[model samples]
Target chain A: MKWLRKDLEKYVQAKEYVDTVIIPVQMFQVVDENQLEKDSFDSEVLAIFANEIEKELSGRVMLAPAYTYVKGADLGREAERLNEWIKHLKQQPFKHIFVLTLDMQWKKSEASLDANLLWLPGLKPTNLQSQEAVQVIRGQIEQISELIRSYW
Target chain B: MAAGLLAPMIRFAIDPVLQSQEKSGDLVNVNLSVDDITDTPQRVDWEVQQVDGWYESNINRTAWVYKDENGEIVALSPICTHLGCFVSWEGSEDYPNEFYCPCHDGRYYKDGTNVPGTPPLRPLDVYEHAVENGMLYLGEPKPREGA
Candidate 1:
């Protein structure tokens, strides 16, 4: 489900049926001049993958808006903030909260974070419209969707 | 004072008669072509602008239209008789050529009759339909007897 007014209305009525929330934790920081291209490409790939996962299991899953952070931001504070978001979402009594991210920095702060952090390997900047890129993304979506279902 | 109190109660009792009554429906014109529908049930989604006095709304409608055994036009409601979830036309390995509801694995035959042992005890509802100049127009959905 999208993060829009219309969808939020539907979510309110079907909150119990939709128990899982997928949050894309995107990192917008570029450490150096050379890292700029990679950071943007990685974020795009994460969005593509997360969007596909949401589409596959849309009936029971809610796609929360992405949580973005700079590379040099305080990890401890960000973790706390993320937890606050999760706590608020729990008012809906969500059973599963997954933070899908491409940033490995979250790995160190995972212990304090309330949501489950799933860090995936970042991909090189490739043409997303190409058949190879789409095929790879689709494969990952199928695997991730199956993993999420296993939790239920 | 007693007549004043009794008069309000009497007015409440006769309120139905004093109020004007009317039956109205927002029948929409769906642009689906009748020729496109065949023995194979096809899923069609249409939208209609519903107007009720002062309130105006647009709603989406779904139906599976096809020809029955005698080649009569049939438009079946896409809703599952169990819980109102949208059902899709089955073209799969398990349930081939039937209406399948993913919510509870409910299945309905080509004739909109629910298969035995499914959660849906009643057959799928049928849509009131009419054809004009090759276009199929759908109306209110009414319940049908259980298969």
Candidate 2:
């Protein structure tokens, strides 16, 4: 289910059935134009991945609002902040929490994080409507969904 | 006397306009030729204007369309009945010629009927379809009763 009001209302009624949460981690920076463009594209790709994953597992997964942080922010501090979000989400007793991101910076603090960090290689910025791009994304989504299922 | 005559004249002119407006929104021309639709189910994406309270926007919708054994065209809603996940044709390596939902391994036969004991409780919904000038137009999908 998505973070939309209607979906949340349904989630409230069937919270027990939804056992997993997917948080998309996004980052952006305005200091460097080049870096900003890359981060923006990456954020778009990450959003697409998260949306497709949620659609595939809507019955069992809740797609939380994205966790966004500015680029060049201290990774240690960001990791701590993310963990606090996870800790609060855990009170809802979600059995599984998967953090999906394309930023490699999260890798450095993976061990410190409280949820399953899925750091995928950054995909080249391409028109998502192209058949080839759609195929590639679909293949990756199948793999990621399968990996999440392994936890169950 | 003049008011009574004008009322019928206005109603005759306005009624056709209202009726045509309703008919125009009834079916979406998917832009795919009927002949192009083969035996295999092809995912067709189309857009329709949706009005939600005060907001109106174009919403993207998808359907799995194919020709049945009798050469009749069939359009099925891709949404899985079990958990509302999108189901793909032959998605699973082990399940060929069937709609597979990756969410919980829900499977449906080529005819849109759910495989017994699968996660899906009902068959895939069938879209109301019509072929006009060799072009396929689809309407809202309706729930099926039984196999």
Candidate 3:
């Protein structure tokens, strides 16, 4: 939260304007039913985390509903899915959409997840830190602010 | 003295005539302005930005910039040390983050590091860059040492 506050402060100082935020939640089912039961705890934590992000970015930013499932899709198909979501958000008249991917698995294939988001119109992509995804999210917010300023 | 003087006069007289006959065509000098050579980035940026997908074409025989999602930044030469041809970036949609050469399908990172599977023994070349005010300046392309 300290890092998030710091990044937000920097964005405000930089006078960056953010319109919409896209938060993607990890929704994968484990093989173990016991693990699945425990995974509910993870989901609850993710829900709370999303709530915090929405609350923090409110008024200044609109929150897109979380992307619930993204586990078993080809990279191209995943990109298409993300594009659909961005199209949906564009209809809302939002100028910028921030996408948050909660992907813990760090593989070369997984890196394409962000690249897929780049295919979306006006969607600026960034990664979430394992320990502090919120801070990384805020840094992207600042970056988007800078991009908007460049246009003005 | 007589023979030497005669030889010199004969050679001087015939040299120009022979040279004129040997000339293939008229040689013309071309003067290029600095602006003409350097103003291409703005034009290329606009043109490439409008295009879709990755382009592996060469510019000025020195370097080619892969126009992916990062806009119009110039990339190093595509010629692999092991073999030569253009290298494509993000060739396989599955591994879309790396630069790949189609010949042997040599792979490289965005920063030009070569991957293990490829025949490329070296990394890609990097172009020098400078920005003056709003304009971007790219330096001459050079081969990547140990690449």
Summarize candidate 1's per-residue lDDT along A68-144 as a digit string, tens digits. Answer: 88877998999989999999889887899999998898899999989888888887788977768866886787678
TM-score for chain A as predicted in candidate 2: 0.97
- Candidate maximizing TM-score: 2
The segments of candidate 1 whose C-alpha lies over 4 angstroms from its true place after superposition are B1-147
Best prediction by lDDT:
2
lDDT (tens digit, per residue) of candidate 2 on B1-147? 999899867876865333333465598899999999999999998878899998997666789999999998889999888777789999888999999987678899999999988878899999878777888888888898755
Residue B69 of model 2, lDDT score: 92
What shift in Å separates residue B49 of candidate 2 from its native position after superposition? 4.5
- Cα lDDT computed for each candidate against the true fold: 0.78, 0.87, 0.46
Error of 1 at B50 (Å): 25
The 10-residue segment of model 1 chain B with minimum total lDDT is B16-25
Name the weakest run of 10 consecutive residues (lDDT summed) in model 1 chain A.
A52-61
Question: Tens digit of lDDT per residue, candidate 3, span A35-71?
Answer: 5654555555455444444433343344455666634
Write candidate 3's Cα lDDT for B86-134 as tens digits. Answer: 4545654656767665434568776677886666667887654433343
Best by DockQ: 2
With a 3 Å backbone cut-off (N, CA, C), the pairs that clash in candidate 2 are none
Report residue A41 deviation for candidate 2 (angstroms).
2.7
lDDT of 1 by residue, B15-132 (tens): 4222211112334457788888798888676777789778897655778888888977888887777655557788334998888765446789888899999878899888777666
The reply for model 3, stretches above 4 Å from the true place, is A1-18, A105-152, B1-147
